[model samples]
Target: NFATLPIVAIIGLTIATMGALTSLPMFWPLPTALLSASVAAGGLALINSIGQMAGFLSPYLVGWIKDQTGSTTLALYALAALTIVGSLVALRVSRSSAVKVAGPA
Candidate 1:
């Protein structure tokens, strides 16, 4: 599932450009796969909310980092680092069988 995140992040870093548009689609199935059909809607909603928040804040954060550092390198690195952290979290989630919800009734 999220096992692909680290690979995508590495690709993004190598490209040195934002790959959100392309990479986002790969993650769309995650919530559905992880949650029961009953709570899948909520899981999707939560993911959407987080995505929207990131979309709204990321530019500002990038700009701030650029202003402070006089370059976008640090910002990109920061994003990559965060991506790695997310990958680790995803790994943990994938290992937690107890978090998997029951199938549709």
Candidate 2:
């Protein structure tokens, strides 16, 4: 994920910059333009900072799981299978539950 950091940063910056630039025509006053830009930049920074922190923590978690299991491949395969089964079960549960709420809609 560290390798993907630069790409993510660039994407975040582009999104924030474009958002502020696009809002320039709508906001009117110069103060509003500056505030819009500041808001966009702040939001982007918050989101990307959280993502970056998660990226760093994920490796440590994977390492801990691998240490417990002795094999990262096996751990990953086990997790994948469990995830598939969980998703299927969740889908069924959701479908059944939704049936109870499906009234006249």
Candidate 3:
């Protein structure tokens, strides 16, 4: 299922639009829009890449822990801890990095 195109598209679209991204036209205020779009794109890519890496690594980490300690609970706890950390980081980021664009609105 890793090579599923529709699933990948859905995930990509969700990540991209999760930040309220939009295509910018090439014109006057369009320049500002383009800049905003680029920033959004970069942020989305960074977040998605990190998320994907974590998703890919988690199972491997769990397997390794299970192999060594013969217990999956520790790995699960580690995953939960990571999730909490990520959530806290996201909350701080959302509060600190609010972007404002002034053109007509």
Q: What C-alpha lDDT do the candidate models reach, one value each?
A: 0.74, 0.57, 0.63
Off by over 4 Å in 2: 1-38, 74-105
Q: Output the number of the lDDT-best candidate.
A: 1
What RMSD, rounded to one decimal, does every model reach? 8.2, 15.4, 10.5
Q: Please name the candidate that would achieve the greatest TM-score relative to the true structure.
A: 1
Q: Which regions of candidate 1 fall more than 4 Å away from where they truly are?
A: 1-26, 98-105
lDDT of candidate 2 over 1-105, digit per residue (tens): 213588886887688579756754543332222334546567456646965886587667668888997767665555557546745764565345332223485
Off by over 4 Å in 3: 1-35, 103-105
Q: For residues 1-105, could you state the per-residue lDDT of candidate 3 as single tens digits?
A: 223589886886587565433321211242233346667667556656976998799899999988988887788678768866865765575556546666684
Candidate 1, residue 70: how far the Cα is off, in Å: 1.2
Model 2 error, position 82 (Å) = 14
Please give the ranking of all candidate structures by TM-score, highest first, separated by commas: 1, 3, 2
Report the C-alpha lDDT of model 1 over 1-105, residue by residue, as the tens digit: 213589886775556545645656656776677787888899899978987998798889889999999988788778779877876776677567435545799
Worst 10 residues of 3 by lDDT: 23-32
Q: What range of 10 consecutive residues in model 2 has the weakest lDDT sum? A: 26-35
